[model samples]
Target: MRVTTQNGRVLLQNDVVNAAPVISTSELRGLGMESVAYIRAVEVEGEAGFAIHAADGTPMAVTEDRETAINAILQHEMMPVPLH
Candidate 1:
């Protein structure tokens, strides 16, 4: 995803998907706070795991398996965004 800002609004373009998702400042402020979650790799006491967090960076859950983490987010009716 390619992120850029225009007039204080954030623009996200996915090259592979060939789509642009626009988020205004107001919308950006609420991103991940609802309806969306993020997945990222983390180190848990020297063990690797996938950490799930709300869009606003609030910790939600952690799982040893990536697929499990994704499914958990989906089961919550949230869109899962994986961060590398």
Candidate 2:
């Protein structure tokens, strides 16, 4: 039997499948507040902008520049992932 990981799930050539990995609340808490964040382009109040949000969905900042938004998250020591 051959096992491999794909998209956080385990797959076996013998026709077995494992569920996606899960993160516990305690484990997330241990990572400290706002350890991760997402940067997304958005239009708000009739203006186009980029927004940064914390892992818990809290709004961090909004700016007219995408790079500025991402850099702001990095300045806070948080991992920033761009959202399409």
Per-candidate TM-scores read 0.60, 0.62
The lDDT, on a scale of 0 to 1, for candidate 2 is 0.75
Query: Which 10 residues in a row give candidate 1 its minimum summed lDDT?
Result: 17-26
Candidate 1, residue 47: Cα displacement in angstroms equals: 0.8
Clash count list over all predictions: 1, 0
Please provide, for model 1 over 42-72, each residue's C-alpha lDDT reduced to its tens digit, 9 standing for 90 to 100: 9999999999998768899999989999999
Question: Alpha-carbon error at 6 in model 2, in Å?
Answer: 27
Global lDDT of model 1: 0.82
Q: Least accurate stretch of 10 residues (summed lDDT) in model 2?
A: 15-24
Error of 1 at 48 (Å): 0.6
